[model samples]
Every structure is written in structure tokens, then in C-alpha cells.
Target: MIQRIQSVFLALGAITSFGLFGTDAAETEVPVAGSEVFADAQYDVYDSLILTGGVLAAGLLLLIAIFLFTNRKLQVVLCNVALMITLAYAVYGGVLWYTDSAAAQAQVDFGALLPVLTMLFAALAARYVRKDEKLVRSADRLR
Candidate 1:
């Protein structure tokens, strides 16, 4: 269970994705009643439904895949799906920054790539899952 390397990878993925909440892609000042308040780019996550959904989905998939260890192939597939979602999330943020102009007053932060770490972990977990599946198949053949 917890001893499995794949499980560890999946857990790390979940942690990193959720941890995005604590890290700011970028920081800016918000004015309220003539007072300036510091804020993080994370506020953008709530503004963009697609980005929010992708982040939540990617974390959820990694967590859910952990329990499906018995179904190694399916677990691998789910991790891959999570990987794709994370990739899209990162690219969407990148594109947003690239296309944005100074007139738009939007902050550009490569820190959005934080989710990419989760994607990397998911990919690693998928590789391990596939390895486990192959091992099982080989064992079955010998039996």
C-alpha cells in the first residue's frame, strides 16, 4: 500500500497540486478604499473556471488512482490523463501571460508551472504502474 513507490509518487503529485494554493504565481497590489492590499496571482484561478477545474481534476485523479492499485493498467491510464490535464493547465497559464499586454495590466508568472511538477510526478507514477503491470503479466505467464 503506502510502501509502493507508485503510491508515494501519486501522493507527492496530490500534495504539489494542492500546494499551489499556498504558492503565488505572482504578486500584485489591490486597492480597496484607497488602501493597497497585496494579493497573489492565485486569485486568477478562481477567475478562470477551466484552470480551476483542471487543477482540481489533476489532484483528484492522482489521489483516486492511488486506490486503484489492483487495476494497474487503469491506474496508468488515469495518471496519464492527469498528466495531460496538468500540461494543459501549465500551457494555458503560459499562453495567457504571453498574449497579455501591459495595457491588460495582468501579471505574468512562470510560477504557474508549479502544476507541472505534479504532472511530472504523475508521469513517473504511470511508468512505475506500467512496470508493475508487466511484472504481473510475466509472472502470470510463468504460472
Candidate 2:
């Protein structure tokens, strides 16, 4: 189920990066409302989307490793750390927006959600592992 969710997210990210979401590119001269109309370039969008996909893929790979190894504590710690960083990224973007900077506007996109999703799944994997461990420990104590 989790794998399926991750796959779906991956596909979504791919579709978004490929301009399925919008037809604006970073390098293209796009027309805005009340402004000159032109096709927009997607360089920045694609770059950010690619980066996000790469990071999410990395986290998924890590989750797979944890699943195979059942390393409860390690997975939990990793998930927590990833969540923190994800939060940081989110906050940073928010701050940039609050400052009313064009750069901040540039950073807004679906790619920003990748770390957050990865963190969530990693944490879920960790919880499963810890629950399995607790069951094992309980059995051992009964013995």
C-alpha cells in the first residue's frame, strides 16, 4: 500500500515537472495578465521538480532498506531527521514569501512537497518496525 502511494506521488511529480500542471517555462517569455503574452519557459520548474524527485527517490530507497533490515531505532531516527529538514525547507519557503521577494515566488511549486511526503512515509515505516519490535519483546518476556 505504501509503495503504491509512493509510486503514485512519483508519477504525479513527473507529470507536474513535465508541464502537465502549467505550460510556463522559466526561460520563456510568458505573458501575464495585463502584460505582453508569450510562452513561458520551464527551466526552473523542471530543475526544481527533478531535484525533488531525486530526493524522494532517495528516501524511498532508504525506506526499502529499512523494511528489509527492520531497523526500528535507526529508521525512526532517520525519519525524524528527514522530517526536521523537510520542515526547515517548508519554513524557509514561507519566510521567503513573507519577505515579498520574487525569488520566493519562484520557489513555490509541487516540488516543495517531496521532502514532506518522504518524511511521512519514512516515519510510517519506522512505526511499523517499532511495533514489530515491541511484539517480539513481549513474546520474549512471556517466555
Candidate 3:
């Protein structure tokens, strides 16, 4: 059960990393000089990557929460890591939001929300795992 949980976590981590770091030729475009509308094409790409990563992380964390009882220890530790990562991502998104225009804030908000949700789910999963662990230990003592 622990091995399976680790595999799933590793798979999620791989997919999220690829989505965050992979460059898509289809998504890139050349910007014309003095074109105010498309001045920050690269930044847009970066934002898209961040948003994708956040969504993937959130989805994975929710899945982990749903399966928290399968491997309590591993899931709890993974949840802790996910919580920290999401918090960091949220901080980065906040900084971006403050530095950019309203349109960029929209993008930042989209990215920020996912990490926040991910953290929430991870925290919940950790709580469930810890509770279950305690219950199991108490049951063993009574045996």
C-alpha cells in the first residue's frame, strides 16, 4: 500500500514538473516591436505554466486526501510537503499579483487559487491520516 502511494505521488510529481517546465512550440509567439498588446509574451508563458502546475498539484492533493487511509504515514508526509509547496507557490503568486496590472492579477489569482486549494486538501488529508493512525494504535493496544 505504501509502495502504491509512493508510485502515485511520484507519477503526479513527474506530470506536474513536465507541465510546469515543458515548452510548447504551439504556445509561443513572436512579438512585434512596440506592440503594447503583446509586450510580455514570455511572461504569459510562465504564468500559464505556473497555473497548470498549481492545478495539477491541487488535483493530486485532493486525490491523496481521498485515499489518505491507504498509506497513512506516507500520505501524511507527502501532504506536509504538498502543503509547503503550495504555500510557497501562493506567496509567489501574491508577489506577481502586486507587481502586475489588473489583467495580470487575474492570471495571478487563477494560479494562486489552485495552490491554496491544494494546501487545504493536503492539510485535511494529513489530519485524517493522523487520526486514523492514532485509532489504529489504540486498537492494537487493546488487542
Query: Which regions of candidate 3 fall more than 4 Å away from where they truly are?
Result: 1-48, 61-68, 101-114
1 or 3, greater by TM-score = 1
Put down candidate 3 lDDT per residue, 1-143, tens digits, no spaces: 43443344444443443343343211115543443323453333255456457545645654554455466787678677767766766566556545543333222213223344445555655665677688889999999
Best by TM-score: 1
- Across residues 40-94, which tens digit of lDDT does each residue of candidate 1 receive? 3233455357777888898899999999988888899999999999898878765
Assess every candidate by TM-score. 0.80, 0.49, 0.55
Report the number of the highest-lDDT candidate: 1
* lDDT for model 1: 0.74
Whole-model lDDT per candidate:
0.74, 0.43, 0.50
Steric collisions counted per model: 0, 6, 0
Q: lDDT ranking from best to worst?
A: 1, 3, 2
Query: What TM-score, to 2 decimals, does candidate 2 have?
Result: 0.49
